[model samples]
Target: MRFIRYVLRALNPKTAVTMDSRQVFRIRRCVVAGVIAVLVIAMVSCGVYGVKMHAQRAAQASQSATSTDKTTAKRQNSKKESSGKQSQKSQDNADTEDSVQAELKNQSASLTDDQRNEILAKAQQTARDNGHEPTQYTYCVAQKGDVGSLDDFANAVYRILNGERGWSRAGATFVQGADGNCDFNIVLSEARYMTTFSPDCSTEYSCRVDENVIINDDRWNGGTNDWLSAGGDMARYRVMVINHEVGHRLGHTDNETTCAGAGQLAPLMQEQSMHLDGCATNEYPLDGELWIK
Candidate 1:
């Protein structure tokens, strides 16, 4: 600024006349050079400031990108962890169900020929040893729908009915007569046909209407979920249902009785199909239930 003021003073007419033409020309040249140098310095300073601003902007952008990447990675890792936990829980539940199914499979195995024969012999001897004349009750086996293996079903009925722990203990013995020629009917029918016998009968369970001892084939094959869950097998379920339904034919009503206590045998007349109510599964009649008639 001082140099600019000095140049302005020198350009005045009086000052220029005092100085020689050469000095005047030199001052003029110096003034122009000084203005150009000032402009150059200002431009250089602006350029440096621009460069610094650009560098700061680039650094900020890079930091933002890095922060976004970290956030996304954290979310992905969290999702993977949640999915892994869900898969593990599902696998554990499936494993437990499979174990229970395997146990039921092992328990459902039928008796061998020798075993059947031995049990039948003992049951017959027990019936005879009761020392009372066996009250004869002729019955017939019939089917409403395709009940699968008529012989197998008939044989099971015969064995269970005449078993030592059956109604035989009460001097009641069942005999299968010719078709349509019997005192009572033990009908093995499909689930859909169960309600046809009477409105009181249901597809979910067995029922006895008059002389018809209706057995639901579904229950015969699959058994009840309640019974199976209570550690009961298909074979024992068959025994219980047969006795339960036949007990109705022998003048017993749907008692819907509960267990005497925990760990005690459930009453054969109890609705073991629905729930055990803290009782163990039982297949035969108790002493009090033997004389239903």
Candidate 2:
């Protein structure tokens, strides 16, 4: 600025005349060069500032992206954890069920052969001892749709029941096909030496059936077959399932008369969820409920 002022002063008419036209021309050229230099410096400063701002913006964008990635990763981790927990819970439930089923299998197994024979013998003694027959009774067979085949299955049951070790068919008989006045139709759906029912003790029960399925998906580990099937586990379940359903026909019902959500029937009925009653719980007794005067 000072140089420009000085050049203007030198270009004045008085100085121009004192120094002549050549000196005046030189002073004006110097002033113009100074102005161009100032412009170049200003432009450089502006460019540098723009570059700095751009770099700052890029850094900010990178930070924002990093934060978003972390958030997304956290959500994914949480979901995986939740899924893992659910899997663990399901496995635990299965294990608990398995334990219960194992116990039932053991109890059911003990009911066959020698043990069962002993119980049957006791039952006959009780009937003879009590000497009171049910009203209009029949060996009503609650037919199972899938006992493999009915004729063969029924014949097998007849052979087994007849050979019951302790049981005597003294007053007992097999009434086949419903005569007009059939009281009940009982079929040996599955004749496993299953459980020893009370000797001469008769229990009558009734229950409401929930979702009945053709396929057996019971809770018991032994499934329907292990209970009293003829073929194998599957076949055993088929027979057991039939026996249970037929057991209901024998006058069994849900044990809990007014339970909340069917407290499940006893084993002989559905899941074989129950065990055969001991002699004490049986309805029939050698001595009557009330003394016979």
Best candidate (score: lDDT)? 1
Residues 12-81 of candidate 1: C-alpha lDDT, one tens digit per residue: 8786777678877899888789889999999999999999999999999999998999999999989999
The CA lDDT of each predicted structure is 0.82, 0.40
List TM-scores for all candidates, in order.
Answer: 0.58, 0.37
lDDT of 1 at 86: 96
Residues 97-123, candidate 2: write the lDDT tens digits.
Answer: 576556434433423456544644554
Clashes of each: 0, 27
Worst 10 residues of 2 by lDDT: 279-288
